[model samples]
Target: MSAYRPEFEAALRLFARASEAMKARGFPAPILVGGGAVELYSNSAVTTGDFDIVTPRQEEFEGELKQLGFTKPVGLGHTPLGWVHPELRLGFEIVSATVLNGMADRDRLVLIDLGEDGEVAIISVEDMIADRMGQYASGTAPEMLEQARQLFILHGDADLDYMDRRIRHESGGDYGVADLKA
Candidate 1:
């Protein structure tokens, strides 16, 4: 039997527990952002501790995580090598403030299952790519050039042109993919 992907399992456990707790008190599931959602959409990223979820306005969920026993895990240190986004240390970036509220619509977001555990919120793959390109290139990671390569190679058919454009426009270095080569 296949074992569980630890990174996914751990993140899912955190997300699902939070979702359940929030619903017990009544709040919408948080919108999943970052690499795992990207892989879920583009079908590329390896299992990683790089999952990041965001709510349009991160209020209720932040309170819920506190209630659910997640006490804002501070960064222990930088993540060791051979992992996903080699920068930004893994863990929740739960925000308890109202930022970017009333800007983007809630309808465009897609829902992906975190197993029978329940649903997880996410933005569009195109949007994820666009967001990655926007300001947090590689989510401020220097080693994410590898993920760009995989995304372009595996999901090339899904959004080759968009990925190509984004990589060239945003990613600061070579992706090692021939078609994506500048």
Candidate 2:
């Protein structure tokens, strides 16, 4: 009776496995980011076909993924860093070597316990909303605005002040969390 959708649960399981392997290998755990964080914070109202993760130790992280039965498909036009677990049929990309390009507050990262599946680190809801706003401000996609709005509306417990500062930083003061409230 897990509340999570199948896709999200699978992603979490895979992330936990990879993270555990990385820890065993003496590497920093990966930070789940992008659409995966959105899906988690949005209660699956927002869904992504793949997960995006950030880790300073990409080489070691990929090695751990390999040990966990993930493979980079050959000649499939996938990004060099994209890896898929065939059984799960879901893939993830190592989007960046640094977490949120080093703009994120490491203190704000949340750890989700997956019981025996281990745990995964995710960006804070405040940071995620700001990230979406940043994407919208950068003209990446109009949907990014809607994603920010969705997260804002869903997480009432989110710290407005923190989000405001993060939004200003991410958007270069072009937008703020207050704008999403409007």
State the lDDT of candidate 1 residue by residue for 47-159, as single tens digits. 55555666544667666655645544335653322122122334566431221233233565776566656666665554455445443355666445454445545554545
lDDT of 1: 0.51
Off by over 4 Å in 2: none
The candidate maximizing TM-score is: 2
Distance (Å) between predicted and true CA of 137, model 1? 6.1
Task: Please give the range of 10 consecutive residues that has the lowest summed lDDT in model 1.
Answer: 80-89
Candidate 1: which stretches are off by over 4 Å?
Answer: 1-4, 20-26, 38-47, 74-90, 95-108, 135-142, 157-182
Local distance difference test values of all predictions, in order: 0.51, 0.88
Q: Which candidate gets the maximum lDDT versus the true structure? A: 2
Q: How many clashes would you count in candidate 2?
A: 0
Question: How does residue 104 of candidate 2 score in lDDT?
Answer: 88
